[model samples]
Target: MEFSRRAFLAGTSALAAPLLLAKCGFVGGGGGSSSDDADTLTFTTWGTDAELAGFRAAIAAFGEANPGQTVELNAVPYEQMFTNIDAQLQAGNPPDLFRVPYYTFGAYAGQGQLLDLGPYLSADTQDRFTPAAWAAVQNEGSPFGLPHHTDTSAVLYNRDLLTSAGITTVPETAEEAWTWEELTGVAQQLRSALPADRYPFAYNWQGNGVTRWLSLLFQADGAFLDTDQRTPLIDSDAGRAAVEFSSSFFSNGFVPANNTTTSASYASEAWFGGTAAMVWSGAFQIPDAETTADFEWGATFAPRNVRGGSDFGGNALVATAQTAKPELAAAFLEFVTERDLMADFCRSASLLPTRADLQGDALTFDVRPELAPVFAGQAATVEPEDAAQVASPFMSGIIPVLQDQLDQAFLGSQDAAAAVTAMAAGIADATR
Candidate 1:
């Protein structure tokens, strides 16, 4: 949830280092002997202030429920979490449990640094989660973690701008989403109506912006990696089309010329400042928009080319391979993910819930009632196949390469076809 350009760039460099010496057997460290000391479990996560407070409160509740158990919360800055965890794992002393992003879940699971949660989960429990959220935590065929929370992407539009531009019909549902061409036509109309300094779209090209590209790729019916996750499929025709379509917005002046600058808040800034009519970004923007913007605004699924899809971003709770008490760790995971508890966490943290059943009914943020359904709809409608593309372990390696190529394409240093080919080559080399 605390994604920043600096943090993501730092993580790319840190993740390239080896985290584990080798894969070992599944059995974890033995549970501590029954002394007078309470069973101590460590939970490592990254966040500050309000986010950290939410985790601490949840852990305190868990401790109170299970009287003699004590769970220590280790809070790290977002930029240092991976490096810190990698060092702990290599030292053979990781926290009993930790929170990890979906992209890194595959890498840790592949190296056998995470406990397999598949055996611990019941069918009914698994069914409680949205399918896409459940699939995001799996490595190969096994689950290494439980889906904690999710954030999906959508198109945030200025209702006043649309209305001023004579656009009466705006997409309110996935089924009624605009096509790429239709969106372009609308942009053109806004361009004529708005001031010259304002653009029609605000494209985020920093931090987890690669996920934005993944959404466009999926919408074009392209996969980032093959089913095996060993081969790169980013050079396909659909992939080329996705990149080309995205680049065209900037090249044609539909988006700001400086859109490629690496600022985490650029998208929101542009929208709130009235420099742009729309922003394709995550659901996290909903809270910010409600508090900052004076104009009438609404959200809907991003424009569809071949199909409707959005970037899936979130973290999951996993038991470490070095946990001394697997049962206690699993219990903590369940406690945090409990239906009512998770709803509270999501509302307090201003995040999207992972549970399909709780999304609409349990969400309590009352600031933007209309936008809630849009975020919930995007979260619930994630295609299982599209989620699988993002869940690939290969993505952790391919992301840096893809980001570089995307920057080149956006800056006109490379053509979309050439950039796609370079991305494919880079991914192939990384997987090998």
Candidate 2:
């Protein structure tokens, strides 16, 4: 919960990359309207069945509390949500409210495409959220969105597979989680025991998820960008160690070769298909895994380097600046984040809550409640500084750099040192 009061950027240029506006031509208000009634607000999002149900329930409750308000839910596939939002934003008719991942929130907020909640929300509202969650929604020291809920990655393993590989004991607590060397040994043991076609594990770094790889860098005490959020800091000794250590997962045959950043297969898919003994995945996968897997599976902490770290894997709810009813939209956001409502959504969706008050034994996960402690413990390792860096407005620009550079390193097209150099250079270009 270590929070920083200093602004993330020193100038407007670093606040958000100009490339987004150029690519999308989001110049604000154009013409169309979703509805004639100012009381009805259109909400766009991509979510699982449970997640959508939670939203519908919250919207129903909001409608009951406020007589004239209505929230129409427009749910789409995850792949198409952003594309549709961008088109709507460019046409100046975006939904009043939309769901956005924390990493992608900065792009919208930076371009001034989002409504600032400071004017609509209470002064003490910031105190309601965890420091790391609040940090993710801030830009230029102001709140642009609300941290609805959060999730983090952990190691999900097939119990029968691990037992077959001569592995019995697993880290039950975050503090007892395996170190990098210990994990390597476990992978080596699995590799020796399993068939050649089968692999030890699969990493969830496909597509835009390349940002999750930063857990290793942060664990090694390296920062992608310095405290200013502009300078590149990924060319140091810690950077090299992270690069070399992660690349070893590929070289040592610990994870599948197709587990590179740009691979078509996801880590969970690999685990489901019995191609991997373990998979590094987020807590959101629990409900599906619990129902889908034939074998008994369990989750453990992600391996630690010098310290434990994990990806901040959840989305935020933001109201568009183009909304006709800003006050009503802000009210909905606040209502959804209330203690009881947030806890219900998290319980239903198997996600972690961002509210500081909900992080306790009082809020039990409905699905796989026994594994909740491991994920909660792993999520606690994400310091406020780590969340702040990931939430930088430049992440949209930096994602491609991480995707391309890390893929090369994993493919052995570039050495660790060269990859670190290219990454630093790419990050420099991205922030500028």
Candidate 3:
């Protein structure tokens, strides 16, 4: 979930790296034997320069706090990170700890490849994180990992474009966020004012980001799966409404024709390149847009429907079942999620914090401090139930289903109902 400006924009256009699941023939194996020097541990993660530096600072602080404890850090590219971890895990020699997205954490935990931290972490540790964040790292009621940080999508707009379109007033708070009908009307106005080559807005659903579309479904008070996480609930009224609304972005020419979920050009490119007036994006893009954008820009809350909602976008820090130092690994996990450490990391990296104490107006960013509250507002809208569904072990399989079906819907190859039906069937199979 930590991305520098350049990496974040590039990632939006590329297909997400394929998850290395058990189906890929990675057989189970035990971790390294207990080490005599338990104080020394190895950790791995992928991050931008700023994020890596923040992590290094945190590790140094941990070393200071606990004498003789050392954490060797291994930095890798995001695309190759999981594949490497899977290889090491299969070899029974994985790092003591590694960073994982909430969606991917389930696959490892479900397979018993991750340590169950419930035994090591204090019971009060649960209260440190937001309910949604705590739920993201849990599997079957046990804490398999800890959500280190989180990010959420908001509306990043070009100031001049809105003024040219005669739209001056914008939502200042999440409670005042634009409704679906209001957003559609805004898009309509922007569309009339924009040139043939430009668009009113673009959605950040390209590639594996297809998961982001769930925010709209959630806003409509719809669940992709029932409470059991085994049944599809995406063929109902909420599903249809969410799909129809998003599909209108394409059919009604509100967004660029090439901005479909499968497109090579992503929403960030359109917004920054001046082809669109506004872009649905996350705070991770703030730094990049702040430096490179030629026009005036700012952020606002994402559109709401029956309720407000946003994508729970971020990664968690987890210990491997194969670590030789379980207690030390758990300690490191606890240290990183501490209020001060998490806040510092989030501020430096242009990401959101997961700690309950640091959310909303509690922590300010080093970059674009004023815009921090907008993303905080978006994060506040993420329901714990929505987070739980997104953090499912089946997400690796479900992502492709969403990409294909949603792409078909946006491309006019399928209608909203048809897409919803296809997604339901695919999800049922994936969960099965």
Candidate 4:
């Protein structure tokens, strides 16, 4: 639990010795004359071409507006981020500023590796975001990060297929909703369009597919782990139902027999080819939908699980100890997070801004009009289900358990109750 400043600083100078001469180009160069002021601050991120372009333009704008300061950026590839970041941080320094996906927020912020900026945001500036998102991103009292943008999971459904099937738009209200059985039944009815080797839904894996399933649990009033966060409750009745819920899709011919997936482009192929009626994904998945669906396509909120919550996410900005200019880092955060900048970044990034009012703004709706349902759904709900935070190391270690153990249930190979119970023990040990 200790910050261990000495352990962090011990080899920094020696490891940094060779890089001192060229550190300006690599680390950003303006650590001011003062000890805490650095000449440069580094940043890192990985993403869409449009989003990256916007980020670079924003950085350039920031540097130009402040002649003495510079922002050196490294857009780390998604596949290589873990490897590169591990080596960089363990070394003398890492990035001054960086993006932390929600999946990793709990781990980093809980560990004290990130600098706190809660006080900085408290000034009349903090009123814009959804409070649930704020709690979701903050750790303890210190705000380790501020959300950059957010998008929740939804069912991207094919309208022509639904209309052809005699169904209208996605159910307007959650209560008029298709319960799990009805959802699968509809998939069975639509399965006629599927050819050999494909079924109804395409699953892109995350948290071994458990997090996605957790939305069901949320609707059912079940939690991923107990309140203490020590054990995963995925083996319980509701947990089993969540598992049973997904299993029904695969078994009932509603979803493809996913044991041997040949391609990750399930979303593109299934929907485009008219092989599947819907797949679950976020707004970032919209651009692909735009290009791929041959018929009218639309997205609707994740069906309400019995308990009534949906999956939610937001990109958070963090300041790492690697920056010598913490003050500048904080200022830049303020600048980018300013409502105007956030709106611009969200537009290009194919995301919703963290600001509540912007959700209804004309410009946002204009860019991704299909997302009106999404905006409305999120605004209607005051709280997103709480997220499960694992330590950084625990993330890598537990993911396989999700895929191998938890997914086995969804794929029909293992009992959901048994598989989920096994993972709970592993989570406890690894977390300790």
Give the TM-score comparing model 1 with the true structure, all chains together: 0.86
- Tens digits of lDDT, candidate 4, 264-336: 4444456566666777776776776676667788776566656455655657888875556666677677667
What's the number of clashes in each of the models? Answer: 0, 0, 1, 17
Ranking by lDDT: 3, 2, 1, 4
- Clashing pairs for model 2 are none
lDDT (10s digit) by residue, model 1, range 1-432? 111324322322211111221111223345432112336678889963656877888888887787667778888888889898999898877788889888777788878889876555544556678777876776766667888988877888888888888987788887778888988898888888888899998876566556667888888877777655557788888889998988888887898877763544667678889899898767666677877889988877777888787777878899987676666666678778888778777776667888878867566554575576777776665766566556677667877887888878988999989999999899888788
lDDT, candidate 2, 233-282, per-residue tens: 88888789998998999999988889999988888888999999999988
Q: Rate the local accuracy (lDDT) of all candidates.
A: 0.74, 0.84, 0.84, 0.60
Worst lDDT run of 10 residues, candidate 3, spans 19-28
Clashing pairs in 1: none
- Candidate 2 contains a number of clashing pairs equal to 0
Which regions of candidate 2 deviate over 4 angstroms? 1-34
Better of 2 and 4 by TM-score: 2
Model 4, residue 167: displacement in angstroms?
Answer: 2.7
Q: Which ten residues in a row have the lowest lDDT in candidate 1?
A: 15-24
Candidates 1 and 2, the one with greater TM-score: 2
